[model samples]
Target: MQETPFCLRVGHLLPYSMSDSNTTDFTNPSNFILIGIPGLEIAHVWISIAFCTMYAIAILGNFTILFIVKIEPSLHEPMYYFLCMLAVSDLALSTSTLPKTLSIFWFNSREIDFSACLTQMYFIHCFSAMESGIFVAMALDRYVAICDPLRHSTILTNHVVAKISLAVVLRGCVLVLPTAFLARQWPYCRTNIIPHTYCEHIAVVKLACNDTRVSSYYGLFVVFFVTGLDMLFIAVSYTQILRAIFSLPTKDTRLKTFGTCGSHLCVILAFYIPGLFSFLMQLFGHNVALHFHVLMANIYLLVPPMLNPIIYGVRTRQIRDRLLRLFPHKRI
Candidate 1:
């Protein structure tokens, strides 16, 4: 033995580093403790307040839209159907991360079981991926409605909508399951503290004793194909949408036609911009601060879910119309 830097004594409960470095041994279950907004542990109490507010609004807003879409017959068209799917995806994404995040920030409860962490990681990525797919699907819906008005109903019928939803859900589940499975199989000999608000796949994988490049690269690949391709296709769809608008005979017609896409366009940009930035930072800026990395990651994951419902409530006419019709009007 050249020199023993960190020693794991037979009965010690905590690991300590005395100055040695070596490969880790991967065996057995390891509990991961999430560190929220790294280097700002003192401010977690305040952070939790903001997060709770976002969560409350996100869940309530999304649930409201879901309720409205479910009961209203007039809004049972394909666009609203896609919107409902979007709401479901947002709810899944938020619920997967926010509750545990609040627990970490408010109660200092961050110890996550190995299996539980794996499950959380799986859902986070899965729901996020699903959300991306839904955006693409929405863009396609708009393209059809705008570019081929007469065929829109025929194309996006109930059967077709159900198939699209199934495809979105299945795509995410199939893609993310492998990463979670491979991650769970990795040997985590030490370093179970995840430097983030939630159990993200890459963050959790870094704790493993084995070489983590495989998971990292695979994660990057999935992101490129899933989120990246979705974005590319959205861009292409919108390009066609713009052409269709310009082809309209009158200016008012063009504006009215494009207005229908505004909410979806906002949602697409909102979701993907931060995601792209976070992913890029991870790829190229290895020297970036851990706190910044964690912050960006949290913003990308949480902001869209919190904001999507609000955007739709304010922007979509059908939703707003139905919402106003929900209450009894008594002029005081």
Candidate 2:
């Protein structure tokens, strides 16, 4: 006897079911496959724990930096202004996905509402663009300090910083708006289950029922434009900075300048290395190796914020001192 599609009706609820023949049924229980390497169960658990820990550290660390900057009158300079911006961006970056990701892992629920998912995607990209813009601004700040020290203060005045901040937010919004809109236009017919813990744009786009070639192209274009071009600018700025430092006759002045840049360099490497590696691995790695790519993606998202405050505090003595003063008598 042919069963009536195995209907599982409840009181006043007509829950639909799929016949065995129907391969694509919205009514069927979501067949979300958790594909990954066999031994990654332990790895996934550890990663989840690490992610939670990093989320806390990132938030606390950035918040502390923000607080110190806000209260410390002496630290009110273009460099510190950029640092504050970066801290805010990191906070937003971590907050955009960490809570949703932690919730999914903690409760073992993969279901995210469509609206919520798109919102997360938008903010994640928005903050990401803002972070890139902030990096560019930081590089410019350093360039001025190193190459044009005589006019550094004059050039990077309060009004200029305000304008740069405004530009960062506006440009980020403009760049990411299309991607978010395009993502929502697609009808999700394939598995609603996102492979990764979060609703990443690429992962979501791959599940679209409609053709996404244009979206993919545009997404890649935006990623390259924002990340690649920004990186190029940073590289050029650092090159000039290095040239200036090397030309300095006094060793002490060179050392001090390098010390100031050390933290920014560390954070930049930490943020970009894992991210670039993940992008490359995703493009070239085999199906079985995709798990590693996913792991890299998780790390790229999680690690930078965890390290940003530590780098900045240790490198900037004023920040470190202010932090100590804030919690006087408490063992740090």
Candidate 3:
């Protein structure tokens, strides 16, 4: 009988085996679970299919949004400029995790290199921050258009829009880079199996053997500082916008103004509400809650991107007109 290889024997013990020819087993036992979710094998296949579809749609939808904004001279205003930024951010956000996630599903391999994992996490945070900033900018743009229409063009001139874009990029860099730096300092003694489909900062941080208290605190601070503050500003802006709209002499003007903002409000709520619920579920409920949290995570990340173009096209006449013009023969 031929002797069994030591590497093969070792690989059997690890949750995930290295793909390299050297055959070194880099498996951490603590990270191994017995695939605890019932019917997880079938669930994995379904999840893979679902994620692949979502990933493809996300890429295509965002790309179309970007293309429309770029080619259409009519969309050169600050609002469309910021819409393009949001599209870019959404593309980056989805791309950061979906490809790798699809690979794991198809290949039955979850062995991501340390550096690759870190890179994915960094971009995930960065693009998410960027999207939040873009939403805030959108609210501000609406405020100016409604509350200070006389100076809308002056206040949000090309130069000013460019400056705001630069500021959003800079803020994303500053806020998200620290997460990568802090994550790198910790030793990943625990199992490297990330539970979720993506390289989420919180999920990965939970696997660190070292103290992640600081990282968690920083993440919370970011969530509160960026999301919390942005939401507050958006609320105030919308409140003032509502007051202005109601005070308008013509009902048509009021309705048009509300129509313009309605889609954005819907998208914002869709993106934030599921995410917040998932976060709360994860924090409060440990066992069964995790499963629901994971499901919500997928919806939160994918649904907004999928719905954004539809929402804007359906809600805004200009966007609908452009879409129709782009496909002139197609009937609505």
**Top TM-score model:** 1
Query: Tens digit of lDDT per residue, candidate 3, span 293-321?
Result: 55777677777777776677678677678
Model number with the top lDDT: 1
Which regions of candidate 1 deviate over 4 angstroms? 1-26
Q: What is the lDDT of residue 93 in candidate 1?
A: 90
Off by over 4 Å in 2: 1-45, 329-332
Q: TM-scores for all candidates?
A: 0.91, 0.86, 0.86
User: Which pairs, if any, clash in model 3?
Assistant: none
- Candidate 1 residue pairs in backbone clash: 5-20
RMSD of each: 5.0, 6.9, 6.1
lDDT of each: 0.83, 0.76, 0.73
Clash counts for the predictions, in order = 1, 0, 0
Q: Could you give candidate 1's per-residue lDDT for residues 1-332 as a string of tens digits?
A: 34333321211122222222232443645577676886677888887787788888989999999999998999899888888888888888988888898888878897889889999999999998999999988998999999999999899999999999999999999999989988987777644556678888877776677777788788988998998899889999999999999999999998988889999988888998999899888768767776788878888878898899889999989889999999979999
- Whole-model lDDT, model 3: 0.73
The all-Cα superposition gives candidate 3 an RMSD in Å to the true structure of 6.1
Pairwise TM-score winner, candidates 2 and 3: 2
Q: If ranked by lDDT, best first, what sequence of candidates would result?
A: 1, 2, 3
